[model samples]
Target: MTHILLVDDEPHIIGLLERALRADGLEPVSAEDGESALQLLDERDIALVVLDVGLPGIDGFDVLRRIRAGGSTVPVIMLTARSGTADTVEALDAGASDYVPKPFVVAELLARIRSRLRESAGASTVLTYDGVTLDMLARRATVEGHDIDLSAREFALAEQFLRHPGEVLTRETLLKQVWELDFDPGSNVVDVYVRYLRGKVGASRIATVRGEGYRWEA
Candidate 1:
């Protein structure tokens, strides 16, 4: 069975989600705080995570940062009650696979999780850009004979730039397409990920637009 890790403080919310997930044929394990959620990672083979932003003692953003740092590939769906676009964008920029606003339909959440799994399972092996090759299926990258191992985020970013080569992408555009967020002016999360990509893709492959965004130089 596909296991889902649900992290939320509200007992009612957790219960509702757990029952719904089980009804949809998914087994869900849950945690009520960031600390417990982080601990769950070590104990569960969770395929996906439903994370709440208002978590205590680490907050959703901090937990996400830690998750990324730990190199886990579990798809994440962030939950936030706020209607602020910035928060949504920030969640995406921080590496959430998707987001669910408070009061979201359980079916919609299930659909999102299924979609992500399909995409991940269907990921292509090789991605080439201006002679820089990223092999998603292989988990390797080669640029002019120099080969390197890429992390999950690196591969995702490389795919984005390769798909839209030379197109000047604002931080917002990159965040949304690559990270699945709406652009809200000043999130450094995108920039941080771009730097990670630069180190992998060779910094020269990406060009910065002063006072604007960036583009794959190709």
Candidate 2:
């Protein structure tokens, strides 16, 4: 079972997150302060950390720094009420894998957690299929030794395809897993992005499965 550490001081927030995480089929351990969070990281086989930035002591940034400084690559998603760009940047700079502001939908946070967990599960940071290779850790893509510059979304979409080569990925699954969107938002956005990806990589690399979806040809 994947263990997630939830660090927040608020009882209500902790309760809400615990219930949501449990419902999502994950084992969640929690600490109400930064010190306890740091300690739990040592004591538990935590796969990810959902940390709140505004804690009583040490703060999320410090905890994040400490985690990195200790050479732990465990994914962390910082939850903060501070919506300022600076705070977000600071958290990212401090080694946060992702950020979620307060008043966020629990579903969205769950989606983010699932995404990070999937990323962490990859045997290596680099994913390769056919002649194409995606270096997830460096956010770089290459085909036949030629570098391909991709937008963040494009990179994510491509990574998903590369991770599951030869398996047909439904458009709905792509939207939810890559975009973290439940509904299509009434657009051919997936198709558009697929087109964009096909343009970057060879069009033949990703095959359309007619009534199904897209599959990365291996």
**Per-model C-alpha RMSD:** 5.2, 6.7
Q: If scored against the real structure, what TM-score would every candidate get?
A: 0.70, 0.59
Estimate candidate 2's alpha-carbon lDDT, on a 0 to 1 scale: 0.86
Best by TM-score: 1
Model 2 ranges with Cα > 4 A deviation: 123-218
Q: Once model 1 is optimally superposed onto the true structure by TM-score, how far is the C-alpha of residue 11 displaced, in angstroms?
A: 0.7
- Candidate 1 displacement at residue 168 in angstroms: 14
Writing each residue's lDDT as its tens digit, candidate 1 over 1-218 gives 98889999999999998999899888989999998998998887888899999987889988987887676656789999888878976886677888889989888988998898787666555677688887653456788879877655667777888777888888877776776756767668778988988887678989999877888994
lDDT, candidate 2, at 180: 54
Q: Which ten-residue region of model 2 has the weakest summed lDDT?
A: 176-185
